[model samples]
Target chain A: MEFEMKIDYYSGDPGEFIKVIEEKCTGCGQCAKFCTRDVWEADGKIYRPINLKDCVECGACWNICTADAIIFGDPKGGTGVRFTHG
Target chain B: MTEDNFFDVIVVGAGCAGPAAAKKTAELGLKTLLIEKSPEPGTKTISGTCINLAGMHNEDLYYILKGPIEREIHSMRTYHINDARTTVFNEIPTKGVLLLSIRRDIFDAWHTEQAKLAGAEVKLSTTVTDIIEENDYVCGVITDSGEEFRCKVLIDAAGVNSIVGRNAGLIPKRSGDNMILYVTVAVELGEEVINDRFSDEQGGYCIEYYLAPGIQYKTWPWIFPKKDTVTLGTGGYMTKDLFNDKITNVNQYMQNFLNLPIVKRKLEGGKIVSWGLHLEYDEKISQKVKNGLILTGEAGGFVIPFLGEGMSPAFATGIFAAKTAAEAIQKNNFSKESMSSMYEDMIEEDLFLQGFMHVGKINKESILKKSEEEISNMMQSVVLGGGFITNAVHTKWLEGAENGDIEKVQEALDFLEFIQPYRQIGSEFEEIYRKLRAEGGS
Candidate 1:
């Protein structure tokens, strides 16, 4: 079976739950390097959680970012990824 | 915080620990409140999907056995794959259930409902965005809606990436050695297909563990069957080497796992249903409590993810935390010293928790120390003579002898002796389970 990285999400806006502290990012790209969901994207000098809507809230990018650039917080309640068969 | 929002005890994150903590606290006559970020409990959670039976031996936990069980598992299979050949060790079926399979979404929802029935007011889809700490004492919490709920003591069952624990300064951003990041996918195989493929004869399903080089790093990949889907997962420690040239990301590991010939055949007509991602803290946190606050479950780091153990320990520790909260409330002392003594003292005495923790530590350490070829050879020895337990002890003993470390050998001996009774606990637990089922609540 080819899952093709398909995941389900709730049908509402989660708001700007994750953001990049541009000054502290340092362009290391560790967040993008380890992110399984492709939530982070490289934007010249910093990595941004561009696809924050698709985030499963696993905290890998935040946990791996050595520079503490990824300002991670919760999306609005009940408005993020909705996992099935977990 | 308003008077209406004040509660005797407040529990956050309605996952495995939160509901148990809330239910027990409410049953103890404390006005308890449960806050969950997800619209539904467990819908945002993920795991290898087996609840170890050792946890249910406590009468306080037997009610869990009566929950919505997908399958009662009695046997385990470990696939030791390498370049040479595949060595599959199938444990002989036991008379009693060794574990139970479950769907987290269903189980957690039911558990939360139980907490509600026990008089705990639950708030679904509410995130605890900020913790209210007054002079180093956790007095209350602020939700996403900016609603503040005050409490005498707060139980943080908010999981590994807990906002409450992180804001409280107890859980530091950790990676590499102590943290584990894993990815899992569920395949829709239908209940008949799962039973047919996994061999659920005699009302017992089986769980599989895979140990291969490209599939995992310092951890075991697993396959567990639910009612209409099979859960397959693989990943490893968050080390610098985890994202190497061979395995660029966790998905590659999952792909490699699926590509394994044995795995490929088993999942042959299955359709991918859902995918999951999660992080787990392996080591126990140093500071699990502050004045007026307590951390249980993953927040306290009482989880061994590879063993499918987080839920059980979560339940165990959550109950203990509730008990500690009751004790602290009775004495009107919300200091860390008081809570820690009441909580950690019980944790220290839990033989099952301590034993599994030791086994998980030594097993992961010893397995990771060797090359894949060496592991296949070692596991072959496990089959030829003594079983899995003896093999672990035997490997440690050999290492100790090679290094001329008598203390290591002595420690190995002590571990063997310590784990001796646990090996035969199935029959004893069957008796206990039958007794408990007959009496009540099961």
Candidate 2:
């Protein structure tokens, strides 16, 4: 059987991240709508990331949090690409 | 005596975007000149409220904004009228916070000073008559005062109705109809008192409310709390019918809604201050730089959809254009390739271009196919009103809720489709809801 590649990096799943405080959620869905990650779904009233590995730690969810439920940890240094031309 | 005219770059419009670009260029050791049509920056510029950070293309200038911001909004409350309910939202993307209402005039003055400190020469009250062209390349800009400033690159941050962009032949004479947005009124109010009275979740700050609705057209009122004063205004989609007296003149249309019980309650002894119009344009993205000319800010049609807020994008564009111009001078190359790198930089930022495209698609479709009422219904149903349903259904009881009816599912899916394009940045919307429910904020 082909092996599934594991992303060893410590990127938190926005889905599980939101689930930590799922019951307290009023389901305004603002987080889901504004998230650059496509992490939350309003229809299901749930937060699940399609791929937790892709999060760049932009901290958008943390800023948008009125409830302050989302948490973020530091990523490994020199892990991402910086657009010098940008 | 004629000055040496040693400027390497001349930027028009000292608004937030213009001055920011000038400051960046100056900081990079480029001889920069910033020009403004008004007595100062943001004097003539008009926008409803503070800028959003999701569209920020330059991170350096984003940090600079921290010093001038009036307040940061971590959450928003959207009222659903038909349902007579309100949905409170906590999650806003981390890109940046909603502006603490600020006086564009004051903020712009500070920005101009920053640019000056960075070594840019700023000439206020200077209006552009035309752009000087050598062959197809824009060489300099001519002011109405019979003066000409020569530079290798001409950056246009001239606000939404940009005469420089049109004159430079960078943008077309006629552009497509995204939405006919016409805003009138710039009423000023006492900031502290207004914020104390009106601001709810984010201090005395900016608040937007829906007054009336339709699919393609809608109108809303805003109370933006600034440093010394507040900007209270209203606007809607521009169509022939909105101006017709049979329905309502623009002024009456606004007054009728503002006088409502809920809205009027907030303005119980308030005064009607100054008023102005914000004529907006929605255009397809094109190469903002051609030859030696570049376009920045709203003049480049960088405003956001759903809310039409663009100050941050404008500022970001300014920074990009100035840096690009500086790079060209450093390399001694001002070709289309050299100058257009800034435009490429902005486009490459997924948020900037993707946001632009998302709003573009929604607006084009809304104006072309949907009626004003339909657009309103969609906004009310999916965004404003729907938010309430989402929050309430998840937290409390829906009274007569059913599991999974195909028809209900289809209707819900259709509603989601209506708001798919305008959904916020990373889809953190649902996360906010989940967190709220888990925390039991009832």
What is the TM-score of chain A, computed separately for every candidate? 0.91, 0.51
Q: Distance from true position, residue B186, model 2, in Å?
A: 4.5
lDDT of each: 0.85, 0.55
lDDT by residue (B38-136, candidate 1, tens digit) is 999998888738888877667788787777878767787888887887778877554887877889889899999999999999999998899998988
Error of 1 at B302 (Å): 0.7
Please give, as one word, the docking class of candidate 2. incorrect
DockQ of 2: 0.01
For candidate 1, the lDDT comes to: 0.85
Name the weakest run of 10 consecutive residues (lDDT summed) in model 1 chain B: B433-442
Q: Each prediction's DockQ?
A: 0.75, 0.01
lDDT per residue as tens, model 2, B310-389: 66667777777877887788778788877786567655554554545454444444434556555445545545444422
